[model samples]
Target chain A: MTEHGEQREVFLGRVRAALGHTQTIVPDEPPAVDEALVRLATHDDDLITMFCDRAASVGMHVDRITADELVDQIVAKLVELDAKWIVVGFDSLDQADALNNAIEAADIQIVNWLAGGATMDVQFDTDVGVTDVHAALAETGSLICNVDAKHSRGLSLIPPVHIAIVGARQILPDMLDYFATQHDATGIALPSSQAIISGPSKTADIEGQLVTGVHGPGKVFVYVVEDV
Target chain B: MSASTTSLTLKGHDILFPPLPYDMHARADLATGDDQLQRFINNATLSKDLQRREVCAQTFGDNYDAMRSLAAEIKQHTLDHLDHYLEQFVDAATGTGAHVHFAATAQQANEICVGIAKREKLTQCVKSKSMVTEEMRLVPALVKVGVEVVETDLGEFIIQIDDDAPSHIVAPMIHKDRTAVARAFERELGSPYTENPQELTQIARNHLREKYRTADLGICGANFLVARTGSAVICTNEGNGRLCTSVPRVQVAIVGIEKLVPDMNHLAVLLKLLARSSLGQPITVYNHIMTGPKRKHELDGPEQMHIILVDNGRTEILREETREMLRCIRCGACLNACPVYRKLGGHAYGAVYSGPIGALITPMFKGLDKYPDLPHASSLCGACYEACPVKINIPKYLIQLRAQMVRRRITKWPDRLFYGLWGMSLRHPATYRFGGWVQKQMFRAKARAAGTAGRGDRYTDRGWLSKAPGPLAGWTRARDLPTPPSNSFRYWWKMRS
Candidate 1:
């Protein structure tokens, strides 16, 4: 095996020598690209402008709140929307229950997953679906979801109106860095699919006109949870 | 598993194998520097190269290694336990109202497809670019039975018009420039003279749109068949694959049995590798997954969905040592990276499939004995293996095929005698020295008599007397012959020592 490896190295050496010159193989160094993400996280005001701008483009309302005020704000919003049922992610169940209790004046049910189950009931039975964002790209203002047994694939996709709670620290520099994190964190193996969704399901396949929510969610709302 | 099934699979697989003695001399002559194909191959390769680099750089940056390694692992896990996923996928697909059929051979697969076409009494069938269909020669089967088949993919459409098979797997017309395409369109479609690619695409789209609306049957290939949902996943740049599956009343996906994976989770992995490797896109334009025919109240979808799981020779391929070829996602990454493929283009390989993957697949699909010449076509640079998204050791397979060729002893007696003599001379110092001495004496005599020793040897009746004798005839066919020197480098080096 060692001899075989040596022979391959020798063959490669010959090919490279015949070609002349060599480029250094370096890892852990950036390939001289603009790091636009540094600006997105520079100040509290800059972060607010980022979310507000993305929300305007996607045609969604934006609101800001403290970590302590989250449960009250969420319950009040669900009540205003007349949410009969709420579907929460696997890890978000406890927080979701706290919000449900805050709005105990109205009865609401919560499904535990975001796959087919969320879609089946959420469309009619539930008024809002809450999810924890895996990461967020400031450049695209897109919420990322990394699917696993804990996080159902459908959470960010199937709901008509999706409310993603993105922790500020989960923000990545760009789409690539976000995906790279997923790849790196997953070790050498990855899942069959790791979709990098910039927005809701969209298509212009017919007549080349933009239409959102063709198959996936029609509306997406990201709540950028600020540090206490 | 039975002998009858095995034989049927082998024969079906045999259908895609290139002709014996491989018409490589002609192909090699054309591909080496064919001015006609230079622009086409150059443009296609350059575009793929730039796009792949840009996308990986932009997305993964320094993390390209992590992405590649992750993608490989995902696919490996899916393939390792395919049977479990296959069952689950079938159950899920059937649950969603899709029908699945397992075909152990191309004949069986075709019969199942033709059976559906026959039952429907379909007269016209529209298809997208599918290697499995090419492997089965599906169009010929349909043609034999008086069914008209239309290739909707732009590249497939161009080749179909000329009654030509696909040369390159991805960019099938990589060997044909815009002029040739314009000519083909002029002759076939009576299209007005224009050499623009966009114009050609518009013409094709306009033509195929009409067929899609009225087609009786839609035939396509599956990139991944999620065993959990039994859904057929297809990724296409053009939306024709989408239209083919949805618009037609009967949608049939003919897929290799190996395309099956455990679930949608596994589907995600293959998609990542496929997109970045093939087109350098984060995602293809359309990733359509069809469950079954449309539901009772559903607005758009096929009325009947039938998936024919083809073994063809795949089961045999599974049994063989080249089972890794089955793990291929059909991304054509190996083809783009191959230096020999870049030079020869795709035509030299001379089969529906071409390039490193094609070289490995062609022989294994057929028998190595019949396509023995193909294994020798490569320089064994190992570029294909390095470039393979899944990291398939393509050169190792090529070398194995070479050994198989030697075992079969397909070379003629004259060639055998020449090689044997050369091998014997290489091993024996005394005989080699004697031969070397004889060549030196002849060269020295010729140079002395010529009176212009600096100018070299005289020309004989046949031509220049570099004196390489008999069957070196093939070597000087397109090159200038060099006159043998009085003393070889080995002798000079020995004297210096």
Candidate 2:
């Protein structure tokens, strides 16, 4: 390991010791997660069009989804988005395998999310980064991603295009519900940096003119999947 | 910049310097340029005026006022029950393993921050754009104790180089153009003189990159403090806030006592309204929630975290009738929507908080009696009240402050005489009509004489309507006013009838 890597390990070790080996969650069931499909079925065409209209506002696309063929649709959506290079979280290996197979078929590179490594170098060059979300908020149409061993929060943020793959069952109604889930899960322990990304990075600071991709991902893609 | 005389003009009146009976609105007026100031005020007021109307149309439609009232009611509820929510916040934050410190004043807050810095033995501190620090003058205090503080925000960095203050709350250097920034950056950073904004941005990014990595301390301001998670949310367009918080060994968040919200739900609503109100955006470039220092098994984040809840005369403000000023979200809406602000910009206010809000706040912080002149600085247009999201009745507060100044005998004797005389004339109809007629005759006689003499150059006739004399002379120094008609509106209507 490099000097910085060694120092990080020592620091992590100290933090782990300070935490006192408290097991917050027993993991009886895998954490439920979801990516909200805004226009799944809505009578208001204006609302639907507005959703799709802002799709390009943040460099995201509104892909129509069918209840069946969840895996196929997600993989196809990633391919169609022209993402040649991709990153996925450790917890997302099951979906990542299917995605990897599709990418292999298309002759693309798939970078797995590592707890520790030189991921910063690849962040600039990576076309797309994927993460298995903690939960998806339906009210704001937001994706809740946190820093953890499995999630590797950097990938969700650092890449130009972030394609978050989430289970449809994980959708929460609002921030209050999500907070309840977090409290019950961790019993008051907070995540380091909890990012609630509603859309791609945007700004209107200069003369009140809207500009996208100022700092964070220019684009955000959510691929909703069913339970395997 | 040593301790110069505290004596200064406020608005347009002149008074004795040093330990005045009231706040100097005359002093501020003297310091500010009436002509140059008009342009700034017009620009801010007009732009915000149009943008607010546009935003209202797009979102609330006719229900804009209703929504604004609702938002105000919610904020008022939150403020009234602040102690309960704050206790809950402290409980939740401590439960999450983060340390929270309470400070009752700016000195206490600075000491707490400095203590944290001293404990860490930090030499370098990088900061994001935070108005709270500007209020406390945190950088100067920190620098006095030997910490090399660097501001990472682009506008802040530009102002720091020029040794200048923020001219606008949001856009700190709005008065400066691209070429001026390019020159400043080139001279300071020794970078190329690239006039392109993109290049300038890249230069700033490159320059700030090293500071972020090397800095031992990261200081930030909270847009909203979520009481539920014990988290401080910073919303910024630049990635520097993220870098500063993420890379530093120790992260310190300095926030006002009024910044707290009950929970994430309330936080969400404010965030949505904040971006839209300030810049008309769906979101900022970064919305970072740092709950505490790095947790076990976490790779990147500060090892230590501290939150300094600075009261800094805020509680004192709450005790007074000026508690509405605390409701300011620092979105610069008042600044953008103010007529006087667009003309004078922020620097002319001569206080950290500028614009109409500054006019209201400056006096309160330094003692209103010292700044009695500030309250009279406004035309009482009520534009600021219209622009405010929480609906702070600024004009009402201003008028109340003025009344207080007069009651305290802070105003000059001339104003009292003028106002008393003016009030008496209105009370008696005969005297009112007689005074009106005499004033009309004097104005007409002066106009007839000037028109006969100056002919085409009527504007140069200085004493035309300016014969009132004394402190009011400043108004006529720049421009001429039109002559009043010989007959009153009543007389004209009577003649027509």
Each prediction's TM-score versus the true structure: 0.64, 0.78
| Candidate 1 lDDT, A41-156, residue by residue in tens | 33333645564465445444555556777777666677777767667662643365566566555566666443345432233345666677666655445565544455644455
> What tens-digit string does per-residue lDDT give for candidate 1 at B47-144?
67667777767755766655555555555544444444555665666676667776655676677777788877887888877888887778878877
Candidate 1: lDDT of B123? 79
Q: Where does model 1 exceed 4 Å of error?
A: A1-228, B1-21, B31-33, B61-85, B143-146, B183-191, B428-475, B481-497
Candidate 1, DockQ to 2 decimals? 0.03
lDDT, candidate 2, at B221? 92
lDDT of 2 by residue, A1-228 (tens): 111111323322332232232221121221122212111222222333333344345455445343456557656767787877777663653645665676668766776536454254455467777676787655445667887656554676667677776565666554556665665764556677877776776543333334455545667776655442
Off by over 4 Å in 2: A1-52, A59-90, A98-113, A118-129, A135-142, A158-163, A166-190, A198-228, B1-49, B441-497
Top lDDT hit: 2
Instruction: Tell me the deviation in Å of residue B433 in model 2.
Output: 3.0
Looking at model 1, give its docking quality level: incorrect
